[model samples]
Target: MSKIWGRILWPLAGFGSFVLVWYLVAVSGVMPPGQLPRPDEVVGTLATQFRDDDLLLDVRLSVLRVLIGVAVGCSLALPVGFLLAWYTPLRQMFDPLFSFFRALPPIALIPLVIIYLGIGEQARLFILIYAAFFASVVVIYEGIASTDEIYVRAARSMGASEMELFRRVIVPLAVPQVLVAVRVAVGVCWATLVAAELIAAQRGLGASIQDAANFFQIEMVYGGVVLIGLSALVMDRLLAVVMKRAVRWQDRVGG
Candidate 1:
């Protein structure tokens, strides 16, 4: 616990310093209010524009989309990655397609997705899946490929069947990397949602920012930006906690 606190304190201190700098910059009058609202002003606008009910609703909506997208992406990617790693011919078949699509930015697909799916939740979900799939598949595939060959060989020597070797040896070895991949996917997937929302429809932090921009609500815009950053930080930290617990055996071995 002390160690965790120590780790957290460092980032907290850095964040505090950042906030101080932002406040100084805003108060120094180097920029016009229209350009950069003061932190306090942004906070005030956040309170005024955000009713208690809708604030939570907006947060929930964005989080729900992120969860759904990441879930679908991981569901597909993990199995696909494992199969590709286990079967060379399968890997050869899909590797080029994966590489091509992974290289394409999720934002680049938004227009086409919107045209096909229209301005609906599906469009947003599509971008999220694209973002999460590419990122997770790369990590998962690498993880599987890098799974210690010694373990697989040892398992075979012990007369373990192929399925048993995969389940008991390979998966256990690859799980640490899979967890890390999920962490990376969380960020990528959420970011893609922002771009997806910007192009299309109705509600979301991205849409909120766009609306604020159109109305010249500079403080609201800043508030939205700040909220998004804070949300991501919180989610990452929560995932870190989960990761630490999930990978405790690995840590113990290293320790």
Candidate 2:
């Protein structure tokens, strides 16, 4: 029982302390009245918005966007990264280009995406895919490339075919890293989501925030931002559960 409470409070301790301080500061009036609202004010705003502002619909749409983005990004990136790592010649030819593309911010591609895909679901999904693809590719390629040479040699000495070697050996060894990549991809997708929705989305957390800020509705802005953050937190925890399940075969998870 004590252990259970400890586990529950362990993560909340930092956030709870921070909120306490914020509440005190907000009430103490170091900043101007409109600068930062009280914590309760923000809570009230959240409650009111959820009750009448179609916040649930916005959340559903945003979640759907993330799901689609993650699926597309993982599907394309996993194969490319695995193949590149296995085939050094291809990696050599593409690494420089890959680096260049990855270094570019996903938002930087928004203009081109708008021109090509227009300001619609495609544009938003493009941003998410662009952000997650490079992230996953880098992680997966590194994971596969760093595979132990001894294992490779042993597998090859047994006359293991390339497909067998990859499918049976490399893939299992790389599952943990791939799962980590999935986590990173999810975060990247969420981070880029707001920027994607800000462009032409009629309804989304990002759109709500943009609208709130335009009218100087600080409470509304904070509420939307908090919703985005909390949503990410929940999804990340869900991913953590998935990671635990996927890596159950390993005695200990390695980087």
Candidate 3:
């Protein structure tokens, strides 16, 4: 029970401290009025927005987009990552291209994406998918590559076939890495949401934030930012739980 309380209280205390600092900054008169609204004002805005149908729709749309993008992106990445790890020649051939694209920010490709895919759902999805795929593929490849050679040697000494080695030995060991890749991809997709929605989105948390900023509705902007953070945090926590259960066999220092 105490351990549970410690876990809850530590995070709550951190949030409280952050709110206190925000309150101090708001009262410091550093920025002009209507620029930095009080924490209370943002909270009120969030409460009011929560009851708004349009805001609810935006939440639903944003969640759907992220889900779809991560699903498609990570699904494709899994096979590609395995191939890259398994085939040294293929990895060498594509490594430079992967590195080049990985270094390119999704936002930087907005113009090209707009010109090619147009300012539509396809454009938005492309950005999200691009962000997720690169973010996950590297982790998956590394995880597979790092698998202990001793395990492979032991299985081979037992006369395990190539198919048996991969299916029974390699795949099981790589499961943790796959889970980690999904988590990384999910985080990247959420972080890229604003950029993805910048392509003329009609409804989404990112779109709402952009609209509010245009009107200088500071409280609404803060509310939207809070919503995005909280949404991402919730999803991350859920994924953490899934990961913990999925990788129970994994040994680590703390465990």
The local distance difference test score of each candidate is: 0.81, 0.87, 0.89
lDDT ranking from best candidate downward: 3, 2, 1
C-alpha lDDT of residue 11 in model 3: 84
Count clashing pairs, candidate 2. 0
TM-score of every candidate relative to the true structure: 0.92, 0.94, 0.95
Q: In candidate 2, what are the lDDT values of residues 154-227, reduced to their tens digit?
A: 99999999889888899998888888888898888888888989669999888898999999999889888788
Q: Write the per-residue lDDT of candidate 3 for residues 105-163, one digit (tens) a residue.
A: 99999999999999999999999999889988989988998899999999999999999
Candidate 1, run of 10 with poorest lDDT: 246-255
Candidates 1 and 3: which is better by TM-score? 3
Report the lDDT of model 2 for residue 171: 93
Candidate 1 residue-wise lDDT at 65: 82
- The number of residue pairs in model 3 that clash at the backbone is 0
Model 1 C-alpha lDDT per residue in residues 22-138, reported as the tens digit of each score = 889988989975687777898888887676526656667778888888888888899988988888888888889999998899988877887898877888888898898898998
What local lDDT does model 3 show for residue 75? 91
